[model samples]
Target: MDTKLLQEIEKGTKSALIKKNIINYYIQSGSSTITELSKVLDLSIPTVTKLIAEMCDDGYIEDKGKLETSGGRHPSLYGLNPESGFFIGVDIKHFRVHIGIMNFKGDLIDEDLIPYSIENSPESLDHLCKIILSFIHKQNIKQDKILNININISGRVNPESGYSYSIFYFEERPLSEIISSKIGYRVTIDNDTRSMTYGEYLAGCVNNEKNIIFVNVSWGLAIGIIIDGKIYSGKSGFSGEFGHIQAFDNEILCHCGKKGCLETEASGAAIYRHLKQAIKDGASSILSKKILEGKHITLQDIIEATNKEDILCIELVERTGLELGKHIAGLINIFNPEMVIIGGTVSLTADYIMQPIKTAIRKYSLNLVNKDSKIVLSNLRDRGGMIGACLLARTRLFEI
Candidate 1:
């Protein structure tokens, strides 16, 4: 190897070692006092103190406050500084953008929403950029202080470059660069479902659990696989594209230009669409009048209908649940994850959804895996996307 290459390699090794110790200290104690970190990292007090002082000077950590002392004086507590830097997480949905901010410890500081239609044209990108800039300005956070930005989009994101083959009609641009240019931060973009899984592992459902799967069942179905507390984006970062999985022999067209996809029959958007058609076909539902009034139908509507014992609505939700359950069963057989965290708008009706999913897993998945695996709704619910984006911002970049 070249002499310069050798020197650069050595520098890289030292940088990793330093970052590793800092990350280890943060992970072990959640937040660490400088003295505690120095001792834990096994360096001499003075040397450790110097390193910490440098870190503080670099805005990686800060002196939070003093701990109360019984005698003499109080000891200052040093921790990963919340204000030293910020991260932005944006979940780009079919209808809305859910954005949130997080500090180093993955604590959500604030969130906002912006709605837009999925026309997928040049105008849509302009609209998205405007919404993001407006949100950043409204928060009053310094753009320079923003270290990382994570964006989740609804289509396949080329993991190597952050380019997307989109369903919506927008100018094709690398999402990471687009956001980075506007926000002046290092931006990471991934598939929405993968981000949800990453979020569950970092803050919500699978925080302590090592093996978990986050299933996103909204306008489309997607899976986020966490194996041993890490998001498992297999070859091409498209490993968990669950929506296109064949679920029926029926001739229903799917968004992916396929037929009989699980998403066509079971996703929240499907439920809303199915209910509208059912009512038009003289199906009896209390929601019928609401639909006639031009009220927007959501997953909540079907759930509420089930609560009121509306036969058609109940059947609709139950059937969707049954299809979802079968798909989950296939996941259980393949991944054998310890927990299956169901997320998305549809998961608000977890009680009704879980029944059929559980039944299907018991019927189709291998007994060995299904016996210990659990299927539950995400604790974060609506917050998974944003929280996941926050965690995604925190993730160390993988080098090939």
Candidate 2:
């Protein structure tokens, strides 16, 4: 074997790798004693102590008092100083963008929401860059302290090359490189669904689950698959296009240029469109009154109406939920995931949606698969994508 290949196999010098691992372990575990670090890193006590001393001197890690030992002297606990670094996580949607600034411990320090539509053109790119720069400037933090920027957007993203095939049309440059060059910080981009799934896996309800599926039910539906304890982005990093899966044989066209896709009948956009059509057809409901008052019915309006037990809204939500559940049942039969996390804005209507989804899953999925899979609402809610983006940035920059 070549010497270069051997070096690659070793990752780096032993000391450098050990230091990196130590930092990552401290970040993940919150704090660690010298003996604990030594055991986890499989290094000598003296070696671990030396590296910890160096890190403490360099202002990376700090002694966080001591941990009570069973018998001997108390062991000093070392943790990453919260001020050591910062990360920015951006969650982009078609009509809005959410930016979160997180500390080294992954706690969100600050956040900003920009209500702006992102167009699929260069002008939009310039506007996005400006928005990001403005947000960072307003945080009153040094640019160097902001270590990494993780961006999560809804689309088919090629993680390796940072090419977003679903959104920007800049054929000549990768989106990550373009954003990084303009923002003056390293950037990493991922699909919004995948990022949310990763966030759940890291800190939400799906923590430590080896096999899990996160279904994001928003304006559109998307799935994030975790197999064997890692995100499965498939060959092109576009694995979870669950929204586009065929759910009906009807002629309703989808944004993906297909007819009868799951999103066509089961997404928030679909529910809104269907409600509008029903009102136009003289359907009697409270939403119709809102329509008469020249107010457009949004997904939120429908959810509110459903809570009020308005027949039309209740029917619409249940129908959409059933359609979504059918697709989810198919997924359960295939993946046999330990957990199915339902997230996104639409998930807020948990009372109206969960039961229908459960009904459909029971009806369509095999007994064994349906019984084993636990479908639950996401705890992180809207923050999952942004949190996941921050985690992505940390993992990429720190190789954690």
Candidate 3:
């Protein structure tokens, strides 16, 4: 190698080390006082001060005024600049796609959702690309000012390659590469359930605990596992495919071409199926009107029906919860996670579902694992997947 190039590499290496330390401090403190950052980073006050000043000059961070003083000068607070660069989060669901934009603080500055389907093989990606491109154009932000684009998708993913195994229409064309190349920014893609779990970890959930499981109860069931603050993508990039685990010996078929899978018996799709049959059998509820109208029954319809004290819907949800809890108890036994986070539209039935879930777990799980683990709802809702994408991109920027 040329000596000049070698010298530049050394200089870059040193700079990256300093930046990594500073970034770690910022992420740990959430937002830090300069003195605090300096102390945590173990640097002289002046050296740390100058480094922060330089980062501010480069538009990476900003002074956010002062902290409380205790008969002393108020120390200044510093935070990642909200306007420095924007990150876009796109969540592709079974029925729709939600797009969100945020600055470094992860606050939602803008968001919109539109109906989307994978039925059309060629047009799906085209439509998705158009939606994102149009969103950026309408915002009037320079393309170069966008730092990263993050996408969350429902289904199996090859985490190492950022490829979706189920979104085969985009096969041979990695979605991340396509988006990044077209939009002139870094792009990230991951399984939606896992993304949401990562978002909870970043938000300091589980008392900042490390091992966590985020279970998404949606049209299909899925789980995201985080070990030591990182996603545990197993061999062949397949881990936590809990939905396909056998939950029953019945004849119900699952989308993954399996019979008696957990999702076939316990997912939002399963709940919808039960409600449709009950309504067909003359069960009475406001949803019966929708059934009479020949309209599609959604997870929301079941949730509302249960909330209205519809006996059949309540029974169905309780049964589903019991099935889910059994699956969860198995996970608790195996992983012994510190926390299990439940998320998705089905959690709307959490009130009707939680007790039965706990009942099943208490009935099956080992006392020790069950004792230390707490099951909770995701704080970020559907937004967790998108936020996790941003964290995915942000971590890359600061990682070794």
Top candidate by lDDT: 2
In the predicted model 3, the residue pairs found to clash are none
Greater lDDT among 2 and 3 belongs to: 2
- The local lDDT score (0 to 100) that residue 168 gets in candidate 2 is 78
Of 1 and 3, the candidate ahead on TM-score is: 3
* Clash numbers, per candidate: 6, 0, 0
Error of 1 at 181 (Å): 2.7
Model 1 error, position 75 (Å): 9.2
Where model 3 places Cα greater than 4 Å from the true spot, the runs are 1-12, 42-50, 66-75, 182-184, 204-206
After superposition, which runs of candidate 1 have C-alpha atoms over 4 Å from their true positions?
Answer: 1-13, 24-29, 33-49, 63-78, 167-173, 182-184, 290-311, 396-400
Q: What is the C-alpha lDDT of each candidate?
A: 0.74, 0.82, 0.76
Candidate with maximal TM-score: 2
Off-target runs (Cα >4 Å) in candidate 2 are: 1-14, 289-298
TM-score of 2: 0.90
Rank by TM-score, descending?
Answer: 2, 3, 1
How far off is residue 130 in model 1, in Å? 0.7
Candidate 2 residue-wise lDDT at 276: 84
Candidate 1 vs candidate 3: which has greater lDDT?
A: 3
lDDT (Cα, tens digit) per residue for candidate 3, span 311-393:
88888889989999988999999999888888877877767888888899999999988999998877777677667766655
